[model samples]
Target: SELSEIHSALKEIEELESDNAGAEAPKNLAGAIKVQVDRVIRAYRTLLGMSGHAQEVLEVGENPDEEWKNVWLLLRRDLQKSMPRGSELEKAWHEAFNVDAEVAFEAALEVRDLAALMLVGVRYPFAPAALRATKASADLAFAEGQRALAAKGYSALMALEPFQSVSRQDLALAAIKGYLCTRELGWRKAEGEFKSWIDANPAAAVLWGEERKPIGALLLDFEKAIPSFDTLELQLGESLVSMPMATLAGQPSKAEPKNLETQAWPSLKIKGPLSPRTSYAMKNLLEVEVSPVIPTVTPTSILVNTGEALYGFDFLSGKSLWGDGVRLEAPRDAFHYSEQDPNLILTAARWQDLVIAPLENPLSKSTDAPKAKSSFGGSVFSHFPVVRRALVGVDQASGNILWTLGGQYRLRSDQASLPDLEKRIAVTSFFTLTVVDDVIYALGTTRENESQLHLVAIDPAQGKPMWSVLLGAGQGESNMFGNPMRDAMPGIPVVAEGVLYVQSNLGAVMAVEIASQRVLWVSRYEALPRPFTRIRSTAYRKVTHANGAPILTRDKKGNLLLIVAPTDSRFITAFDAESGEVRWRTQTENAQ
Candidate 1:
């Protein structure tokens, strides 16, 4: 009955296409046809939701109904040709995942849906080694003297293999190219293809000589064939741990013994010194400020924070690719150092398909009476309003804002609340968002009284809050006349080994277990009196200046060390990463 109903809808669309033979397709009529197609898609999606579909997804031996299979094939064909991209249609397309993984993959490939094919590949248990079958098929073709067809098959199979099989697949591709080289005209084509491969995989390409190599040699230690981690000249800031790219690509890394003394201070070539006034101010500011530059590199791109914006740059050219592209306002001062630093204000975490970052201004703010103060209480950007922040998800390809998490921040309820600095501080808490294991850890504070810190966990895939844990009270209330706690530099939150290390301006270092959503250990370094006033008769209040991100690294013995350096203090403490036991403590001057 449902099959007939779907066919009837399909017939209606065919009739509409016939009617539009000469003139343009009418918009209203097209809309009506879309409604019918959507009905069939919804029905198919509903069937996919049924428990029967679960058998087709998880149990390979159990066959799906032949009638249902044919029904889906017809629906898929129609949808692939006419269905506009929409959430419902996408959901329906995703439902094509089946127990028969090979068939499912072919269906997706036929539709040119790479995303859907990837989804099916992940869901299919045998898809990782699906290349083995293709390899065997190509071998048969090659043995039968079908050189052209076999070469084409080998190229297609190379495209399908996972990264782990990359070495083996490259060898397979080399063999096919070798076969092409034996022919007179095909030698040029083979040379061109080899050059292309060499460009893409220079390290892997080096193993092969200018002439073709035996296919067997192509499998020569893929691990060693890959480039070493040292190839990337990543500029990780002082007190940072770097991960080797090869290790992340599933290659085992040998732990090289490092001399801590020599590694501590990198050789420096100073251009010159700042002016006396500026130098003095910088020294004092450096004591309380921690400028962290977290760099993430992909094969094609490099991402870095320049204090003003999160930038994606072309890997080879070092030219700017795409920026967060969020501009606050026109700078009043010639320096352009306004309420928004605009240089390194945004931090980002890269996931599978999204670049999640802290949305500095979570909500739209009023532009009428714009006013922003610099660290020295001087007007940096003239007439620029204070921009508060929240978490925003950006599309990796287009660098567009896909979704935003966290509440919108409006400094003033109306024009009258414009001067309320307390509300401004509450709405804007220093946050460092880091992505690990497909989850985004948002370490910051909500715009609330008492200025309590909020650590939120978000699912980057759907841009939804998974869980949240409240930490220590923020650097306390704002002091208008005295040293404002908001201006105090915040320690960046670092995520490593499934734990988040965050230090607030209040001088508290917390190790939070991300999965458990609980504090592992809290190390409070120091605290000072709040309101920052000297009143012998009044009650004593204290505040902290521990606002920089903690650094995590492994020592020579392979024991993980969590380094906590408080911005206010000259001392840095090292703790055992797993047990939270104090390993060592050293003064910043002595250590550096």
Candidate 2:
């Protein structure tokens, strides 16, 4: 029956090839035939070992009734003679099959090998089928370890083309799983490959698109996958690439980094329905040297800074109740001022230095001055008395300065001349001051130097330094000037529960025990490894408001608002304070 089937298959192949003589025949047919004959020969050899003479008779080329041995030898010789001398069939048989079968099968395959290929396909259809079957079996093995098996299956499928839609779907799923499971195989590579394949087969978009959504979602699951700076770069690059020809007609071909930087740091425009109108001004103009203090008290009074003195106004009615416009001699351009209490204002007067003026009566009119100067102990009343820097303080009536403080401290000149003065004190310049309780903080740089930051605690009552901490070592006057002003520290020191929270410009956040002058805890901000230029170039603005407790805002690289809680384990939280809490989270971004 097997012999008859082989004969029938041979006839069918012969007729098919004959009909396709004008067309290209299947290319691998000869190799396929050799594979089949090799298997049959092995089986015969095994059978001969089991049944001796009987198998030998069956193996002969001729009938047993007609000298089968001679006939068999003759048939084998003829087959060998018919084979092509130098072909793939000859090489395959030689490498893969036994020597005897190699010679015989090579001969048989070369003779248009219909019988051999068909016989092999029928008997051991399993050679290639087994490979396909093993692949399915391996996929099932994933039941034990889904990720590992899925990865292996994906690799295998990626090397071959799928014959069916189901097969393609399976392969795609495996690829997605593999990408998700292996960190070594990053999402970028996987996405790239997927995209490339989709591009090659545009029609597969429907199938691939369905798969892409999940893969994309999986990629997004990795919090640190795509950096914000990189995203920005891509966005900018795309925008540039997509620019209309008309738009670029007169412009330069390339955009400079400076141009991008300038465009990026635009001053925020306060506009919209919620924005305060420009015509709106607090009533009762009072001049204080410091930034205004907004009191939390009902019918709150906001203290305003007038050129020389401090004044308080009722926030509701915007009415100024009282102000002492006392013209005291302040440091040259003595804008250095602050209000400790709505009634008590501290101003750094020009030549005489510091002065603390106290208003005698509230809601009382008349240019009557108090009888004696309120004693903060020292004749010098302002915490900052440096010649070039302003002063900061809180007004007597409102306690709003608890969060915001500003003043400048200048190093005075020994010589009468301005140039000589700049040389003597190394002229460190501080333009802003912050006072917490009795401690006063100054943020500024020296003349012809980098910005300098100094934390000085003073007896507000006596105008004396309790303690002073210099942020950086001063690189004094140089013939060739460098920016002596270092970056301002990330956030101001939050003084709460007798402890101070300080964040360094270098991203180091430290908690200091004020009394002991000891660092309680230290934490570093999560930032990309980049040069300080990228960091310093970013915009930062401090935000202050009472949220559960007093929360201080420090912009991290101009992209994130770090809301640091000084009293609560020094927890530095984040929120999109400008847009509300909707998009409050920290994400990494590449630095340009």
Candidate 3:
């Protein structure tokens, strides 16, 4: 019955296409097709809700109804041709995902209705690999001989595979595909390490299925080619276990014994002092009430956000400019930035000559969150849920609120729209914000869903977004590897030569072409979930977690290299920007 209804809907769409046959047909068909596609998507959703879509996904064998399969194929062909971009359905999908529908469809293993939902929206909080069958896409890319795509795809998939949403079956399949791709590409995935992986994971045996024989025939070794834990020497700090980095289509790294201390260091060419001393001491300008924030410095002055107010200071003299500071109502707590003190790095942009800064302004404080038992313990309030923040433009000369964007920023609500859902959607906390040619680029997660990161370009003067793209790993993913008491580390984005390079603390680096917002590649260094390093605060009685940032550098060969020390504590990894492949990783966690 549902199949007949879906056909009727498609027939209506076809008839409308035919009826409006002319140069003006597409213009006329836009509204009608929207309605019909809406019908088609709803019907499929209802059908999937009733059947084998147990994990909120319908795969090849999940529902093998031949008639339904044909119905979907017909619907998919039509929708692929006529489904208009920028529709409400697409907006909803984009609201929750970064990749377009087709890529998501391929990731979902060619589920026709999945494609429809791409034009439509997924019910989010997905159980799939970052909201799609990214593993399947990588496998196809490898089969098609697209090494770069396959490498990056597998890189991203492996990093995200550890999340709770990904099933063990899917993870095992990913590993098997990884083994095959490595073998085909001649990349250095020693059979020994793979066998070790299977040995450690007996579950992979059950899913090995047909691939078992071929993989078995290949030279097998019980010992790993890469050095095992016995060869690992723990520094006094971290014990981040590592995994095979074969997904990048790069050569396996040769073991370098810890001779780093004996190696000669490069000269910095500084003629004079190697270390600098503080030039000025300016205190009492403002009290460290609720933790501290790294101030925004300009050529003439600095803008300081104390979580309760905006303070202006004379850069030349480091003296307070405003008395009592321009106190902000419902100021956000700053304790969440770090465990012991404030995270000293935050960005501030200039719009219409006003300082644009992200400040947390809470709605209501929750009692369930951990409170500080020590001094200025009120700062601990910012660490809890139900916090709202905004990008505020402040008058540099007078410390006046000029304009505020996103969420119901109470300071100047009239300048920004207020929505009940604003708590989750607004551009709240960003790791990096930069203004290039008058357009502001921001990368951060939402207050509600820290893992759902968004990269947005904004018109600072108008306080509106020009366009926004979701980055990776969204829909409320868990920070399984991060410090249990803290949120996942947000990746700091570095833009160069029109490409944006970002890394998830989960151990993957991604490059996006800025002009088209296309994700060029991802290189992953997925490691087994281990306890992250954290520091306990004696003053605040709270534990501080490890935080690392990435930077862009060029080698002597003039090639771009992305270097980052993920909180994983294994090694500081470097990736080739052009190919998204691992260039090198330090032998030890603290080395270099």
Enumerate clash totals for all models, in the order shown: 24, 48, 1
Global lDDT scores for all candidate models: 0.48, 0.34, 0.48
Query: With candidate 1 superimposed using the best TM-score fit, by how many Å does residue 291's alpha carbon deviate from the native?
Result: 8.0
lDDT of 3 at 488: 32
Kindly list the per-residue Cα lDDT of model 2 for residues 522-571, writing each as its tens digit: 55544322222211121221221111222434342233233644221223
* Number of the top-ranking candidate, with TM-score as the measure: 1
Candidate 1 lDDT, tens digit per residue, 366-466? 33233445657443323322334556677768877787654334444554454443343335444566665456777666534455676777778877666
- Poorly placed runs, candidate 1 (over 4 Å): 1-294, 306-308, 323-346, 362-386, 411-430, 481-484, 487-490, 526-549, 553-559, 578-581, 590-592
The lowest-lDDT stretch of 10 consecutive residues in candidate 3 is: 275-284
lDDT score for residue 480 of model 3? 22
Can you tell me which runs of candidate 2 are displaced by over 4 Å?
1-300, 304-311, 321-388, 392-410, 413-451, 472-486, 504-506, 520-522, 526-585, 588-592
Off by over 4 Å in 3: 1-295, 305-310, 324-328, 331-345, 365-386, 407-424, 447-450, 474-489, 526-549, 588-592
Better of 2 and 3 by TM-score: 3
- Residue 538 error for model 3, in Å? 16
Tens-place lDDT digits, model 3, residues 34-114: 577658766776686589552343444553332233344334445544434433333333333344444545545555332
Can you rank all candidates by TM-score, best first? 1, 3, 2
Give the range of the ten consecutive residues with the poorest summed lDDT in model 2. Answer: 245-254
